[model samples]
Target: MLKHKCLDQCIACTACTVQCPVTAAAREFAGPKMVGPALERFRLFDQDIEISADYCTNCKNCDITCPSSVPVSLFSTLAKAQYRRQNGKSLRDWILVNGEMFARLASPVASFANITMNNAVVRTMLRAVGIADRPLPKYAEKNFYRQFAELKQQRFPDKVVFFPGCYIGYNDPRVGMDLVAILQASRYEVIVPDVVCCGTPAVANGYLELAEEKARRNLRELRRWAREGWPIVTCCTSCGLTLRQEYCELFRANGADEVASQHYDAGEFLLEMLEQGRLNSEFIPLAGKYLYHAPCHLRAQGIGLPSLELLQSIPGCEVNVADAGCCGIAGSYGFKKDKYDIAMKIGERLFTKIKDSQADMVVTECGTCRIQIEYATGVKAVHPVSLFKQALRFDWVG
Candidate 1:
């Protein structure tokens, strides 16, 4: 069912191949154009070759540069799922995909979990399981939902539910807090729902049934707000994309396609706010060279780099759009022991570019990319919203 859509549109001009930084960096590696179609061929004959799906970092550069408008990364993900199904899921897959379970289990003793993650023994175990040379994020003292519950109990004017994804909810509550502060400052009521996993990890790992179940749950929870004409805002690109696209798949299968069409990513939602003159900010001069790493999923959404647009609006900020491709942390792909070296190798070019640029900070919309970039560059990477929040705090633009 997931056949490559743009096969007929492809001119074989090699435009996509040439535009891909991944292919350019790794000459032996097949770019998305070839890989996507090749998977179709492999699937046709029911061949079980792995096709090195783990090699793709899912940066969406191929999609961004493709002239024929192919959904390169989406198809590549589908192909990865195919390969994962044949080769069997890795230990790292089990760890990353069952993130919700781990979060819930760790919530009771979150401090212990946080300490354990930072421990040398635990780091070795993590490396043994597949993650290498990446620092794990510390778990929050309090989860996002708990923090949201406290805020919601108090009175507010306009309410907007915040979907901070699993990482922000559990690992980095600062992001959630910052988002709440921003929404409150904008005079909007912020609600934190008792949300479950967004099912992106499941979908990526080929657990389609599990993903669909989670999607249905999320839809039922958000449908009321949708009916009320309120927007569901998420800070993570994967969560936003899952809400915008995968939830639609659930509706299409259940004969409710129209409702699925209304989901919005944070960038799309923010751009809408900007156009409507609902969002305004005081520019804070952030002195430093800033590079924007567009996440693969964000690029796949075809939003025309709204994150960079938002960043550049702040005066005295030098934003560099990196020619560097994926950071090679394609969710759980780069964390596996077998794929760790390859992931590092793939990420080296981007890391080197960022280091060479001598940027003050790297900003991106995807939480995973932030993690990967920070791990690779040792430069603090943050969400664009955080910078925007900082800009709003300034007294004067000049």
Candidate 2:
């Protein structure tokens, strides 16, 4: 049996609580130290102490800030799984977490779905059911999977597997198309593997078993390519983080370590190529002041701002890190009615910073961060890879 990792290592240093955006924004959240490492001790004895793990948001700020290297967010995630086992999940959670299922179902009638989601009556009904009144992402008429099927790519000896998470695959396929163009331009053949949701939304919503099962399934396919030394890359920060770190830390799924070792964020992968002098430097110079927001999960990976590094290398592209903290939409966390206000409150710092910057564009790897930034600051947000595609002057036909 697997034991909870590093709970004993916590010396009760309140660093995690200090860095917790949720705790700062909302008092109801019992703070990471309290609900995580502290209550975790009680949970070890089957004490079943009341925990506010639901408010965690699983942003991994605790893990990032923990001086002792304790997996604080893992404890909260485990608590959520345990809570789900005892009390079951709500309808709102079911709808929010099963994004892939809903996306597939909604893909056929995407236009209608988008219209229905924006209808005032629909918003009222969604609010009653605990979904936030904030605008939902519109479903793409052709999902990334369908678009990838029709895509014809120039063959290259080097190949990389692309894991476009549910958001890019279903909601905004243009990002995936941008990634494909960038990869192809870099002389890498892109392979869209038949992978599941990377289990982030499910894990965030407390579906531990479901998340683990999906992890194992993905590991099987990912490991096959990994063993052959093919790199697994993702445009989504959360999905990339899940593939590279969470699987090993949380599920300990077989081959998770091997797969983790080879996984890379698309920007990180491109940055590597640029550093190795393998990147295509023939770029159309686009002059603009850009602000980059590093996703919380990406920061947790301990990779030092690869997207910012890459974006800065482009001629005439002035890029600056937002450094304003978390955007507060922890996957589907902000979509919940009760948590929406807290999410917005947590995001205000970033919003204020973006508004102050007067940036021509905001660049970020996380899709939800783009949504939250645009929604809060009324600033346009584009993915770093998408920006790179634009720099390369690639015409994207969606």
- Most accurate candidate by TM-score: 2
- Give one digit per residue, the lDDT tens place, for model 2 in 51-136: 58888899999999999898888888988998898887888998888889989989989999999889999899889999998999
Model 2, residue pairs in steric clash: none
Query: Which residue pairs collide in model 1, if any?
Result: 59-296, 130-335, 130-336, 130-337, 158-189, 160-189
TM-score of each: 0.84, 0.96
User: In candidate 2, which residue ranges exceed 4 Å CA deviation?
Assistant: 1-5, 393-398
- RMSD (Cα, Å) for all candidates, in order, is 3.8, 1.7
> By summed lDDT, which 10 consecutive residues of candidate 2 come out lowest?
389-398
* lDDT, candidate 1, 277-396, per-residue tens: 676455568777888888777766666788688778778889999866677776665666665666677778789988998888988888877887888778999888877777666222
Q: Each model's C-alpha lDDT?
A: 0.71, 0.88
Query: What lDDT does candidate 1 reach at residue 186?
Result: 58
